[model samples]
Target: MRISKWGDSLGVRLPKAIVEELRLKPGDEVEIVAATREKLVLQKADDRMTAFTRMAERRLTMPEDYIFDREEANKR
Candidate 1:
């Protein structure tokens, strides 16, 4: 596969055969598990629980009295 310029980023256009074999569709997320000068490896991204685990590892803290307001968070 060849990488081409995509707006401000580089992108590879996956061949139709690989796309069909992987069952990938537009907007599906992928993770690059490994890369080297000669090789690149990609896998499907983990689900929400993995995201939460990574977030927890960041050790983010908030004020004890803080309360989450769904409406405020959803504001555009």
Candidate 2:
């Protein structure tokens, strides 16, 4: 793919074959998982619940004395 100027940033237009293969549609999001001078890897962005589920699977632990302040969270 050839990179072209997009406003102030550079962008690449995916060909029709790749678009169909990936089942990509307008407004769909993709993330660049890895990049180097000669190579780049892209993957579809995960949905919110999928990300949350992955986080849950990690089974992170909190401090025993930690407390959540609902009012503080709500303020954010």
Candidate 3:
């Protein structure tokens, strides 16, 4: 791979082979981690935060005894 100047910062043009190997698509989120001074790793983001936020929008039913510690919590 080769790095090219994009306006100011340098950018690398991912080859078709790499895109297919990593199963990457346009507009997908990726993360870069520096493993060593001469090495870099690229990976897809887990998107856990987005998943948690989506889960938070749903309603969940709790068990009848789920409030067993409510009295203790109220003392705080």
Error of 2 at 69 (Å): 31
Measured by lDDT, the strongest candidate is 2
Write model 2 residue lDDT over 1-76, tens digit each, in one string.
8889989999999989878877889998888899999988887676865666776799865578988799999999
TM per prediction: 0.59, 0.60, 0.53
2 or 3: which has the higher lDDT? 2
Model 2 ranges with Cα > 4 A deviation: 53-76
List candidate 3 stretches off by more than 4 Å: 48-76
For model 1 the TM-score comes to: 0.59
Q: At residue 56, give the lDDT of candidate 3.
A: 68
lDDT of 2: 0.83
For all candidates, the clash counts are 0, 0, 0
lDDT of 3 by residue, 1-76 (tens): 8889999899888888878887888887778865788888887666866575666677544465765577898999
For residues 1-76, could you state the per-residue lDDT of candidate 1 as single tens digits?
8889989999999889867877789997788899999988877666765766776799765579988788999995
Give Cα-based local distance difference scores for all models: 0.81, 0.83, 0.76
Candidate 1, backbone clash total? 0
Residues forming the 10-long window of minimal summed lDDT in candidate 2: 43-52
